[model samples]
Target: MSAITLYTGAMLQGAVITLELTAGATVVSLIAGAAGAVGRLYGPRTLKAFIFGYVETIRGLPAILQLFILYFGLTQFGIDVPAYWAAFIWLCLYGTGYAIEIFRAGLQGIPEGQHEATAALGLTRFEAMRRVIIPQAWVAMLPALTNFVVLELKNTTLVYFIGVQDIMFHARLGVSNSGQPLAIYGIAALIYIVLNGTISRVGGILEKRAAIAS
Candidate 1:
């Protein structure tokens, strides 16, 4: 049988797992990031300080190190995190660190007059942020959010280090079994390129639409 035929099933399965990890991480990270941004921007001093420290600390650590701590080191603390959960959590936290900054910058980029106008209309803070502030900020946030998604998608490969059976893991298996490192690794690279390219294309379209809308 041909190498392509031999490896197609395993690669596809791996791709699905990678996509799942990316999707889950992206969603949770965005939610956490938005909340973190809001807290830093509008909450009291203590909340802001706490969020700032969390973001700085998470951003400072390398993701691989964090993953190792989650998967391996946690066992010493009598908390055994499953490899898949560890990977998922790592991706979410890592993405969130950057996402918080992206969202904060986007929200802050809006003019102070916008907030004033909302107050003048007697809109409560929650209503103003939900109805007026966030909608406007989405345009500014889209490009950065898109970049974050792509980065997270690529970073999913790191999950295989803890044996999550992602694309790279399957590629390694294919290499070992078929002894065709070039073909296996080449296919893995192509898969990533396609996924990243798709995200970029979609992001570009959204950006254009947002620009026209604004």
Candidate 2:
């Protein structure tokens, strides 16, 4: 096979790993963000404080620093996190911080009358949120959430710093072996663009559907 063909194949293999990391991290972060937003808005004071601190701390620290702390610093205390898990965990936490704010804003955007209406109907807070508040907020939140997913997908490249064999890692390897940084790195960039483009497209479709439903 030609050198270009070999490099492309390796990069494709790496893309699969990138997809796995992105999907897992995005799903986890969305769940965490939604929970955190709800807790901050209506939970006990202590829970609110805890979620506030977590969001602040995660947002304050750089993503690379968080990954280093998990992958390397943890070993100092004998925790010994695997590289992949470390990367996955860090992305989830990082994405969740921003996601909380996005979701919180969406939730808070609902008028106070809506809350009163739910209470008047004898709906519990949880029931009201699940059945009424969240659906409205979700439509407003969809665009921001989609942007977060795209950002998370790009951030997956940082996993290579911790030795995850993701797309950028394979691209780097191919460049080192074939001494064609331009072509190899270009291909890697293209792959990321395609992946993110697809995400944005899907997000647009969802947003339109949500708007119509709302």
Candidate 3:
């Protein structure tokens, strides 16, 4: 096989792993972020403090360091975290910090008068949030959230550090076997470019639809 053909086949397999990891992390982060935003905004004092600290700590720390702690550091205590789960949890928590802030800003952008209006209609807090707040916040939040999603997609490359067989990992393997660092690494970079480009395009489409609806 030609060099290009061989590289393409291996990179495609790596691409699948990359996509699966990104999808899983995105889903977990979104759910966690929504709950975190809600709790930080309206929960009791202790709950707010805990959520606040979690978000801040995650945001402040380097994600690679967090992954190292989870993957290597924990082994000292006999806590064995598989490479996949370690990467998964790290990305989820890391992405969730930004997700919480995105959602919190979105929620805060809603006017207090909206809540007052909902109350005037005799709606409960849950009803007000469901019927009035969250919908608007979702639209307002999409652009930032989309940006974060793209970042998370790029961040999946970091899994290579932990020995996950992601695109970057495969590229490194190809470099070792084929002795062509530029060619292998270039292919990996191109794959990332394509994936991130597609994400940007989809995000734009969603934003347009959201704009039309609002």
Candidate 4:
């Protein structure tokens, strides 16, 4: 079989794995990010401090180190984690840190009077955030969140380091089988480009809709 054909056929499973990891990470990041932002913005002083430290610490580390800690380093200490779950958790945690910052910036961008206005209307803090603040913040953060989603998708390739059967891992397999590293790697790169481009287009559409809505 031609190298391209071989690589394409073998990559199906890897592609599915990539999608699954990306979807899981995206969901985790959104939920965790929103919570983190809310805590940092309005929670008690101690909670805000804790959240800040957490975000800063995670953001400071390279994601690959985080993956290595979960997959390899932890095992040495007798805390064995499965490779797939390790990747999932690491990406979610890594993405959550950035997501929190994105969301926090969105929240901070809103005028303070809006919060006061919600209070003036006798809305509780929770209700005010839900009804007034979060919607607008979401609109502001959508582009950044979309970028993170794409980055998380691309970062799934890093799972290959821990032996997760992702696209890059399969590409390596194709290279081994076909002895055509350049062609196989080219196909892998194209696959990544296509995936990221699709996400960028979707994000553009969403940004326009948000602009019109706002």
Candidate 5:
């Protein structure tokens, strides 16, 4: 095959790999984040502290360092995970912290009267949250969480360090093998920009729909 032809396939595969990791991380993070956010919002003092600690700790640390620790340092203790798996785990952890913060912010953005009205209607806290609070919180939080997903998609390139052969990694290989650094890297950049742009557009549409809903 021609150099460009082979490189294109590799690039596509790399993009898929990156998307898979980001998708998995997004799902995991959203669940954990929603749970953590709710925990912080309504849990007792000790539970709130623990949730706060987790979000603070992850947010304070560099994600690259976190990935390295999980991939390299943890492996040294014989708790080894495959490079892709390690990358996936670290990404989930990193994204989860950010999601928690976003959800918390969304939850807080909710009006007090909304919750009060639910309780005034005889709804318990859980029912109020399930049927009233979370849906509205989701709308308020959509912009932030959507932004976070786009960020996670771009940041998936960091997995290259763990030898996951993601988009950046394949782009690097293409540049090295073809001696066309500009072409290879530019292609990767365009792909990422397009992907992120699409996400942002979708987010905008979602926001509009949410505005209509609320």
Candidate 6:
């Protein structure tokens, strides 16, 4: 079989693994992000300080460093883990920090008067946030959050560093098998563009909806 054929088949498995990592990481980021944002906004000063420190620390580190720290560094503790889990945990944590910032901006974007009005009308703080504040924050944050998720889709390739056999790895495998580096890597790059482009289009639609809501 030709190198292209061999790599093309490998690319299929790589795509599958890539999608799994993206989906898993996105879910984790969103859930953790929203919760963390709420805590940063409504939690006590100590909690806000803690969240701020965590966000700044992760945002400052290169993702490759984070992956290495999680995969090799953590494994030294005798905690059995696989490349898939390592990539999943690191990406989700990476995305979580950014998502927290996005969510914080969304929460702050809501008018202070809106909060006052909700409370003046007999709503408790929790009810005000739940019924009025969060809905609006979601609208404001949807665009940024969508963009973050699409980025997550691309970031799944980081799994290659930990040997997850992601699409990039498959491209390498195919090149090895067929000795056609040019065509194999070229095709792999095209697939990434296709995936991220679709996400960009979706983000535009969501942005429009958010604007309309506001």
TM-score of each: 0.94, 0.94, 0.95, 0.94, 0.95, 0.91
Model 1 lDDT at residue 71: 88
Candidate 1: 10-residue stretch with minimal lDDT: 1-10
Q: Which ten residues in a row have the lowest lDDT in candidate 4?
A: 1-10
Per-candidate RMSD, Å: 1.4, 1.5, 1.3, 1.4, 1.5, 1.8
Better of 4 and 6 by TM-score: 4
Cα distance off (Å), candidate 5, residue 110? 1.2
Of the candidates shown, which would achieve the greatest TM-score relative to the real structure?
Answer: 3
Q: Please tell me which model should have the higher lDDT, number 4 or number 5.
A: 4
Q: Which pairs clash (backbone N, Cα, C closer than 3 Å) in model 1? A: none
Candidate 5 per-residue lDDT, tens place, 20-61, comes to 998999999999988898899889999999999999999898
lDDT of 1 by residue, 37-145 (tens): 9999889999999999989988898878888988899899899988999999999988888899999999999999999999999999989988999889999889998
Which candidate number has the best lDDT?
A: 1
lDDT of 6 at 93: 93
Global CA lDDT computed for model 4: 0.89
Candidate 1 residue-wise lDDT at 89: 92
Q: Which digits, one per residue and each the tens of the lDDT, describe model 6 over residues 1-214?
A: 4668767778978999998889888989988999899889889999999999989988999888988998899778987678888899998999999999999999999989998899789999889989999888888777787789788887887778678989998987778877888898889988888888887888888878777877
lDDT of each: 0.91, 0.90, 0.89, 0.89, 0.88, 0.86
The TM-score measured for candidate 1 stands at: 0.94
* Model 2: lDDT of residue 24: 94
Give the per-residue lDDT digits (tens) of candidate 3, residues 1-214.
3765687688889899999989999999999999999899989999999999999998888878888998999999999999999999889989888888988999999999999999999999999999899888889888898898899989988999889988988888878878888877888888988999999999999989988987
lDDT of 2 at 168: 91
| Per-residue C-alpha lDDT of model 2 across residues 38-104, encoded as one tens digit per residue | 8998899999999999999988888888889989998999999889989988888898898899989
